[model samples]
Target: MLSIQNLHKTYGAQVLFDGASLQMTPGERLGLVGRNGHGKSTLFRLVLGEEDADSGIISLPRNYRIGHLAQHLHFTQPTVLEEACLGLPEGEEWDHYKAERILFGLGFVEEDMAKAPSTFSGGFQIRLNLAKVLVSNPNLLLLDEPTNYLDILSIRWITKFLRAWKNELIIISHDWEFMDSVTTHTAAIHRHKIIKLSGGTEKLYAQIAQDEEIHEKTRVNEEKKRKQVEVFISRFRAKASKASSVQSRVKQLEKMGEKEKLSRIANLDFAFHYAPIPAKRLMEVHNLSFHFDPHKPLIHNFNFTIHAGDRIAVIGKNGYGKSTLLNLMAGELNPLHGTVRSHPDLELGYFGQTNIDRLHKGQTVEQEIASANGALNRTAVRTLCGIMMFSGDNAEKKVGVLSGGERSRVLLGKILAAPANLLFLDEPTNHLDMQSIESLVEAIEDFEGAVVIVTHSEMILRAVATRLVLFQHGNAEVFNGGYDYFLEKVGWEEEGKQHR
Candidate 1:
């Protein structure tokens, strides 16, 4: 077993862990979940010896091999295959096929394996690192957001691969479905305490919520008893005949200690503001085609129509033009050979993955959301800001100084401020936490408008996709069914290959 005992860590005023202890049983694939800044990554660093805890014991067996995916970019070999094989043990160095399987499952092709690692993009380099970690036969595998750079196909393949893990594993991901699919146990970091539970993440979170509720109820009952004692003492204080009784009551009230109230944790909880339209046809794509290279078009002769209350999910590999399809329909990219027409009364709210970068550097969170102030009054704007987790002074923080996740929230705030009949969201769940993603999913499902979302998460797709725009085998086609139908009748093209 891996034991962490009496762990206590603090950074200035922020308490990350306090006397927290947890144990990992053998063969347990634990999914670690916590809100942002709750030290999910910090715990990984502590186990890896990359960071020191303030004071604690993280006891692992001596000579235990711990494997983790590297973010560093340093290549020592000429070919991608050679660099990945460096992770193999001394006698297993000849097991190149294992490395090949992992690399292929992670989206690497046979032709690409011969090329230098430096020749690939940053995302591909990260995948190469992931392949190395997977190839290494370690006692414990610690993966943090392994699906971040992967496509839907690769994510699917990895879920299968991880299910076959024989040893212990710990993974951190915002996609609960992905985590829950592979994990045998769930552990969470709540209120600077480690909570480990069997089964999926939902069980752990539900337990935590129940515990907090019980704590609050107990506190309330204790307060009521204390108040009753005080009243009795006040009513008999000046009466000499009841002097001893009042003194005893005062002592009883003193012994009834107060229960500390749990601090409020801000969560992303806001619905999208919908501007309903009477028109049934919101958008039309007539033979749309777009290409940066005339000889090799990314999108060619694609056709789809958008109707009110339609939930269209665009899905494909990384460079397969899923985002391009959204951009073409959204007027961010002009079609080369066709047209995309929208109803004039349609109110469009776009939350692109890259659009967060377009947020004005000098503008505060309040200013950015307030830019769409025509739809919301001053008090509503403040309330919206608070719901986006930017209460009071945080709303005034400049966009230039905010992190990627914070900027994503600001964009959501802006979307909430604007009343729109149509929404075009491209990977909006990238930097959000698990709870935040659930809230966004609820908001999307509740909106009375057409939603065109570009996503790789099957969880979101299964929950909301009424129709699908598929990029399969280098062709874009419309599948007039739900995601489950696509999985049952026609699956991803990559699933046909035997990478295992």
Candidate 2:
């Protein structure tokens, strides 16, 4: 068992947690959730003794084995198989077999096992890191954003493995569906405190939404009463007969208007505005195939069409050419075999991982949006900025100081500000908060244009995708129905049913 009591932690003037406490028992899995800089990782550091809390006590049994997945991978071992086996006892056949099994489960083949960790892509490197951690067989695991670089298949495999493992875990993942799958408890950091609840993330978020609604209603009613009392006091205070009544009303007004700490939840407000131009056929791919090597192809004989109002989701395991397909259609990548044709009038708004880095650091949010399109007027630019959570003076802040989530919003704002009829978005919700994700879902639902998105986030796929493109071993198939139908067809009916 692990227990944190009367925790108080702060970084300079920023108070992250004050008097926060939590308890986790053996075999319990807890999901830790919060905004980007809200101390989720800090809490992990505190628990691991990498940092010290100003005032607190974290108690655990002696010799409690803990395994933490490192944020970055730097393996000195000669091969992937050797690195994964480093923690296992030497000369033990069972340990060697377990390590091999973990590596294979995470998509490492026999050939990959002999390759250096640097030979893998960033996503595969993350898998290697996870495999290294899992092979250690710790009693408690601290995984931060475990699903960040993983695709659907690897994510499902990891989820299944964690569900059946009898160990304590504290995970931080933005993917709500993944969190709901393995967590036995949910913990959220809000208003400088942690709220721990039994059950999964879905129920916890639902309760938070309901509580916010009730708080808003209560605040509105109090404001109305306070305004009425103030009005009565001002009108009747001058009259001699009503002086006493006015004094009483003044006291009532003071009581009603007394400052109370309102709920600090700030919701994201945004919308996508697209030109009402329609094209029957926006893009077409015919016999498309791409390969780095002449004899082997990552994508082979792929064919698909994009029309206005088509919301297609591209999903598969890591390095399986989901993003390659999007780039091919967007003309970022040239196909070796077939051709991709697009409408002459089609304007593309593409948002990928690198788009955030492409933003100008010297420019403000308003300047960034306005510079993206010369035709955008001051009001239009400000409107776009406001939608991206840069309100009033906030629109003038330099982009260089913005956080990852803030930069993502700015990049999205720039994309939406354009008059593109087709959007190619890769991992649109990667660093966004729940409120921002909700706004994005609404924006996509209301968009009149088409979208080709490559994302691992089940929430976005379920909310925005109307068509599905499932990628497998060097092949692709398009499902005519929605995300649920695709999930059912792909042997995820039970998982999909639980989330639904």
Candidate 3:
């Protein structure tokens, strides 16, 4: 029930949208795909009237109500329950159960319902806004990275929640599995155009590739014909008898249309530098116990072992000792009780959200990547920069001027350039798009060493996790099986009852 007609948007030297158009059928679920700065969110703002397009028609009915997860937070109510209930539509304010079901699914406890909204953390505050948007029941729901703040349990809850959605939805997410699971169609922003298709992302991407391939072949054939004409004209020009023929060829060459060669798109393509070792046992954890309070232990008397070629995923609800354990394993934090023993030749590379702050703001992207691995020479450094999609002069961009996504890429480039037998990553997909996350999946799959990550994406977990460090029921424990086995045998405990 929504349509964008011949959109043309630009900002100075950068062209965000050029004659881009998309149509959404009523009750359609669309998964929007594009690079980070390719105008996915800009299109959202254009539809919402927050930003004006240079020239376009974004047509929707007068009664259409749009719901989005607001970045700004201004809670009029003090209690969490009351603040959430504020999302109830007019003449239905008494239906607080709708809000409670959403709040509970979003990880709010019974006790938390009475707590002040201001007392919650920034991430949880964002979730509160999300709950409001979800409960509002708008005609068109636009969610951009709703899973960024969610834990594995909450993500599962939202997945189920959105699958039952009857209204229109346009979601932009790096978690392909989630988007593919819920969406009926896939749409992408490619070459300044919106390509919409039925079925999933794989099908849509294959169609795009086939179209581009045909375009390239046509361009090549036209170039060959033009070259042949030019060569015929040049070779026969000196002969008096061939003068008329050469003139005709010249006329033909002049009439031939010129086609611009398509530049190769930059994509994240690189493998992590693996440092192989003969030893099987990489690290051992003995009676690991850690806590911020003496009365409550988050990880208590936990024991686990890390081996070479291991893919261990630490998973649970947010604030439930996932990242804490990752930090402890990476040696960023010390355990309160127990020993985390490592092999003598253990080499580590870590990608964490907090690590972004450690980057030198004054240094360039190339400088930061090279600093991670001192043995890498200038050529290797530039190659790594190119692998990160920072080509030519963009490699010299100062870290201070980079966006959050760019900074995350620099952090990953550092990890890839270094020699690491063991990797510790926490929410590595937070600042990445679909393409970059797919590249990350390949890098993890191709790496010869071990990897341990904390992520909310079931897609990545199912792909890489051979072992799991599960935090559930107020205890952190290790599960010997993969994510599929865990989901089949031991699903998320304490999740709210399915409302659908």
Candidate 4:
């Protein structure tokens, strides 16, 4: 069990939290949700004693075991197994058993245990980090974005593992479905305050919204009553016989008035226009095969056809060829064997997860859009930027000084400003807030073009995907359904059974 009381933290001028409090008991699973850069991570740091809070008290039971997943990790070992073993406590028997169990759960085979972790891709390294944490088997676990780079199968594994776990857990993740499946309680951070909810994230959010609606209605009713009483007093106060009663009614009205200035919910509206239809066939792939190493083909015998106005979603686990497939479609890579053909007049707009580093350091947001070959006039560009929540002086600030979300918005703005009939997006919702993501969903829905998106976000898939393509074992299999249908056909319930 652990408790955080009267917690307060601030960064320079910005107050992250004030008087925030929370209590956790054994076997409790809590999901922490908030917009990006709102101190969710900072709260974890405060709990772990990795950072000092401005003022607060964090208390845990004596001898309580704690485990946390580090955002950035450095492994000095030569192999994945070695890195995972490093987290094991001393004693040969316990270390060997835990190491083996963790490696197996994380999808590593006996042969892979000997392979250098550095040789693996970043996603694999993240898996290694998770394996390390699992091997420790602490009583309290703090996971931040644990599903970010995991493939569907691995994510399923994690969800199962957590559901079976008896220890207390506080997880922070952007994946809505994952949170709903694993967590029993919700903690939301809003406007420098923390709200604790008794139900899961989705239910809690719904209840909060409902409560706000009820509160607004009550406030309105109270205001109406006050206005009626005021009118009565104004009309009857001049009469000698009714003066005392009118004055008494006015005093009661003043005492019973409601506070009407509750904060309004933030909402965004977005629309996008696509150019006239170009060609029937937007892109074609023939016998496409690629491999980082000769022995292991990431994608092989992949062939597909994309047409105008088609919204295709690529689904797969980590290391499976989702990004590679998008890159091939974008003409960023040559297939090791086979031809990728694009129709003439098929202009493309590509957004990748790693595009944060692609922005020019010296260019301001406005300057970056202006330099894009006159595709958009100043007003149109500014309006697009504003829809992304960048306005006034923020648009004039240098891109280098912008936060991660701001940079993402700038990049997205530039991409939207371009004229393209086909768009290839890789995890485009990574750094976006919920509001911005909804705005993007609206824009994409209105665009008259073909879209190929690779993401693990269930919400994004539900909003945009019309066709599902599953990537497994170096092959692509097409399924004729939307996101929900794909989940049903894939036997998500059966996968949940595997967890038990």
Clashes of 1: 0
lDDT of all predictions, in order shown?
Answer: 0.90, 0.82, 0.90, 0.79
Per-residue C-alpha lDDT of model 2 across residues 1-500, encoded as one tens digit per residue? 88999899998998999999898877899999887788999999998999999998998899888889987778888998888887664455356778888887777777987898888888888888888788777888899988877777668779899898788999998787788788899999977778888998768878887877787788888878888888898888789999999999877776665435465555677666676665799899999999777665678888899989999999877666787787788888899889999888888888887677889999998898887789889998998887787889999999999988898988888887887788888888888866577777787888888988888787777888888888764578788888878756674432444468
**TM-score computed on alpha carbons, candidate 4:** 0.85
Error of 3 at 215 (Å): 0.6
Candidate 4 positional error at 47, Å: 1.0
Candidate 4: regions farther than 4 A off: 76-78, 89-95, 218-260, 264-269, 442-446, 458-464, 476-500
Over the stretch 149-260, how does candidate 1's per-residue lDDT look in tens digits? Answer: 9999899989999999998999999999999999999999989999998999888888899999999999999989989998999999999999999999988888888999
User: Which of the predicted structures, 3 or 4, would earn the higher TM-score when compared with the native?
Assistant: 3
Which ranges of candidate 3 are over 4 A from the true structure?
Answer: 232-256, 496-500
What 10-residue stretch in candidate 2 is worst by lDDT? 490-499
Clashes of 2: 0
* Ten contiguous residues minimizing lDDT sum, candidate 3: 491-500
Model 4, span 1-500: residue lDDT tens: 88988888998997888888889877889999887877998998888889998888889999888888875769898877778888785465346767866676666668988899888777778788888887777888999888776766667677888988788899988776678788888888875778877777767778767877898898888888989898999899889999899989988987995766577544445554465655899889988889888876777877789988999999876666788888877877888898889887878878886566778989989888666548678898888667666778777889989887788777777776777788888887776665567678887888889888888777678888999778764567777779888777674433555468
Candidate 3, 169-288: lDDT as tens digits: 999998888999999999998877899998888899999999888888998999999989988988999999999999999888888878778777778887889887778999998998
For model 4, what is the C-alpha lDDT against the true structure?
Answer: 0.79
TM-score of each: 0.96, 0.86, 0.95, 0.85
Minimal lDDT window, size 10, model 4: 264-273
